[model samples]
Target: MIKKLLVGIVIITALALAGVYYAIEQAKSYLQTPLALNQAELVTITPGTSFNRAIGLLVAQGWLSETPYLRLLPKLYPELTNVKAGTYQLVAPLTAYDALAQFTQGKEHQFTITLVEGSRFSEWRQQLAQAPHLTHQLTELSEAEIAAKLGVDREKLEGLFLAETYHYTAGTTDVALLQRAQRNLERVLKKHWAQRDAALPLRSEYDALTLASIIEKETAIASERSRVASVFINRLNLGMRLQTDPTVIYGMGEAYDGNIRKKDLRTATPYNTYMINGLPPTPIAMVGEAAIAAALSPEQSDYLYFVASGRGDHVFSKTLAEHNRAVRAYLKVLRNQ
Candidate 1:
């Protein structure tokens, strides 16, 4: 009878071992199983959200199935429980293991907003207001108030933010993003200003930025930037009015109807470079690094004038006669078109 009892105990131990192995296999399968999602979805986990609660929320949303094996996941791999809080993008054909891995690794969904070169600060504000999932803190604030918040002068805020694609997770404030851009601009501008040509005639970094903005508005052609800069620099040296039409359009504000009248050039405004003898009071628009670099280090040339060639580029000229001929040619092209 004692021998029989020993045999029964051995059998019971064997069955218990088998049950443990089966449970582990089931949990592993559950981890590898794809989530029940037909489309991509965003899941936001607020701060202090527990791993279990996150799983439960997914289950409730029908993206995940409730199973006993899910409880075993954390026990089998302890690191799976260390989920970070942020918005995550879950796509189809992804397994439960993959989703959990993303959460634990803090792979939050990233959104991007591009601030274009030569665009106005007011236009940038409109873009930020329309960006999805971004926290809108500057919606009601005036431009002056926003500048004050950023510790910048209200009048000098137009061209301060760098033009670049900024990426951030959800809940990022517009002001926070602007601050990052502004900081990047400051660092870049400082570095470029220090390396600038001494004969540039720029009084300060702000002067370079103002000049850069004009260059930015003048041309979108990559090769034309430094040449355009040279024209402006030559004109500045000769004490010639910039006479740039973009400044006139900027001065016209809402009254500009896709055309600049001769009278507009004569009308005096702070931004009217035609009437203003020097650089405008502030930059008319945002400028990229390329424009800024050109402003600080212009191509050496005697060019004093430029006009659209009607071929998506400018015909640069060193004399008024050449410039007038080019302008007449441009008008002929316009008339023919």
Candidate 2:
């Protein structure tokens, strides 16, 4: 009777081991199974979310199936439970194991917002308002308030942020992104200012930025920037009015009807280069690094005037007579067109 009891105990132990092996095999299979995703989807994991809760959310969304084996995954691979909090992108044909790996490795989905050169600060704000997956903290704040949040001392926010593509995760704040851009602008401006030509007519780095914004608006051609800078620099040296039309348009603000009239040029405003003696009180637009560099170290030339060639380029001139001739040629081209 005692021998029979020992045999029964051995049999029970064997069955328990078999059950454990089967459970482990099922968990491994579940981990390797592909998710039920028809297309790419976004999954947001908020801060302090637990691993089990995240798995439950996936199962509820039908991306994953309800199974006891999913609970065994963390026990089998301890690292699978260390999921980071952020938005993740799950693509089809990806196995459940790989998706979990993405979470564990903190491989969050990235989004980009590009701040374009020659665009106004107001336009940038509009873009930020429309950006997806970004937290809008500055929607109700005025420009001055936003600047204060960014730790900027100036009241004017124009030309303070750099024009570049900024990358962010799902929960990134608009003010945070702007802060990065502002820091980048400060770093770049400081470096360039230290390297600028000593003989430049610019009184400070701010003056260079102001000039760069003008150059950014004047031309879109990459090769014409330095030459455009040269023309403006020459005008400044000769104490002549810049006579730039972009500044006039900026000064007109909402009153500008896509045309600059004789009276508009005669109107006195701080931004009107035709009426002002030097650079505008502030930058009129966001500027690129190339424009800034050109402003700090303009090309050495006798050019003082430029007009559109009607061929997506400019005709630069050293004398008023030559500039008038080029202007007539530009008008003729426009008339023919």
**Candidate achieving the largest TM-score:** 1
Estimate TM-scores for all models: 0.96, 0.94
**Cα TM-score of candidate 1:** 0.96
lDDT of each: 0.90, 0.90
Q: How many residue pairs clash in each candidate?
A: 0, 0
User: In model 2, how large is the Cα lDDT of residue 311?
Assistant: 96
True-vs-predicted CA distance for residue 142, candidate 2, Å:
1.8
The collision pairs in model 1 are none
Model 2 per-residue lDDT tens digits across residues 44-116: 8878877787777788889888778767778897887888998999998888788888888899999989999
Worst 10 residues of 2 by lDDT: 64-73
For residue 99, model 2's alpha carbon misses the true position, in angstroms, by: 1.8
